[model samples]
Target: MNYNQPTDVLLIDDDVVNNFIAETLIKRASKHTNITVCLNGRDAIEKLLSIKQESGKLPEFIFLDLAMPVMDGWKFLDEYHRLNIGDGSNSEIIILSSSVFRRDIDRALKHSVVKEYISKPLNIELIRKVLKIDHHTN
Candidate 1:
């Protein structure tokens, strides 16, 4: 993926501090992208649906958290795929969670919508890899 192109990113996490930290890391990783934050899965789903309906395009990328109130990442993925949210090759998903279970990784990979699985303590290295940004500047 070209990190220089403007990409729309949706970040869904229940924890405020994690959200803030992740967003900051992402921003540092790639300056050419836009990040939108949602506190929970339900809200993320609603916002994503609305954005798609209004803009005729789903977000280029999504970073999801596995656990939360109202709805969880698994539920969101179910709903998203059920809705056929991807607009061909333009959309992708990345799962962000504290879960280190093999089952979790397996489940994430099983879904066609998901493109990558990442663990917590979000930092510059993960961001660089995910965004495919060069590290020479750092």
Candidate 2:
């Protein structure tokens, strides 16, 4: 994936400060200026449905946080799969969370839609890796 190209991204997290940092880093790293932030999984689901209804499209990437008050990441993933949200799109869900437990990592990676698991305090390098940005090109 080319970082220079502008793409839509969905970020689901309840942390305001982390969200701000993530949005800034995402914009700087992948040039994904179009990012929608949802405080919880439920909100993310609503946003995804809304976007699909409005444009018949979905974001290319989804940054999911494991823990939240309203509908956790696991529940969202279940709903996403149950609803076939990625049937016609290349929407990859990346588990972006602070949890570093081995079980958490294993469980997340086992999920079909989850492309990769990334720790919190996301930086430019992780963003590039998640977006598959060619390192040499940049």
Candidate 3:
């Protein structure tokens, strides 16, 4: 796949394997894309704050996990909103979770910051769809 535009993507997951898989999938989707990994929501918030302070910018995409140590995705969203970090419009927070519960998905989607919700094991097709790239054309 090819992405004409460069994208900064953040993967916030407690699982190392999940992070690796997401990173690989993102790379496969577009070589020009940059991927950042955060093991927990706390670290991800810290990283985002630092980036905003240093560069006055946020990642274009954020792959968030609902269940994580230190701070969960819901808590992170609360903190992120409280801190007034990022413009919210620029960054797309996609909830990447293993939760099969409809309630969980509905809650996540109901959040203003959350753009979409996807199940675990982020794949090439899912990445492409998220990026709004036509697989056939790419």
Candidate 4:
């Protein structure tokens, strides 16, 4: 698989601090990425639907948090599955959560839509690894 950074990335996390940190890390990892932040899963879903309807293209990557108010990541997954947006190539979802429980990790990995899972406090290294971006800078 190509490890090039994507043009568009969506971040679904309720915590403002987490979102800020993750966005910053992503920017540091790849300056070309355009990051969008959603405070809850519901809004994220809505935004995605709109984007699909309008542009017929989903975001290249989605960094999702497991716990949120209006709609949790699990619920979002259920609803997203119903949408059947992409052909499993255009968009990839990564679960970014603080939950270390084996069950949560297992459940997330089992989902067809979820590509990977990462613990909270996203960093530059994790971002590069997840996005498959090269570490060496010219």
- Candidate 4 has an lDDT of 0.87
Residues 1-138 of candidate 1: C-alpha lDDT, one tens digit per residue: 564467788999999999889888888877777999998888988898898789877777799999988999999988888877664646778999999999999999899878899988888898888776677743
Model 2, global lDDT: 0.88
Where does candidate 2 have its weakest 10-residue lDDT segment? 25-34
Each candidate: what lDDT? Answer: 0.85, 0.88, 0.88, 0.87
Assess the local accuracy of residue 19 in candidate 2 as a C-alpha lDDT between 0 and 100.
93
Candidate 4 displacement at residue 16 in angstroms: 0.6
Model 1 misplaced regions, further than 4 Å: 87-89
- The candidate with the higher TM-score, 1 or 3, is 3
Off by over 4 Å in 3: none
Error of 4 at 66 (Å): 0.7
lDDT of 3 by residue, 15-92 (tens): 998888888888887778889999899999999999998988798889999999999999998898899886644889
TM-score, each model?
A: 0.91, 0.92, 0.93, 0.92
lDDT of 2 at 80: 88
Candidate 4: where are CA atoms >4 Å away?
1-6
Query: TM-score of model 3 relative to the true fold?
Result: 0.93
Residue-level error in angstroms, candidate 3, position 107: 0.8
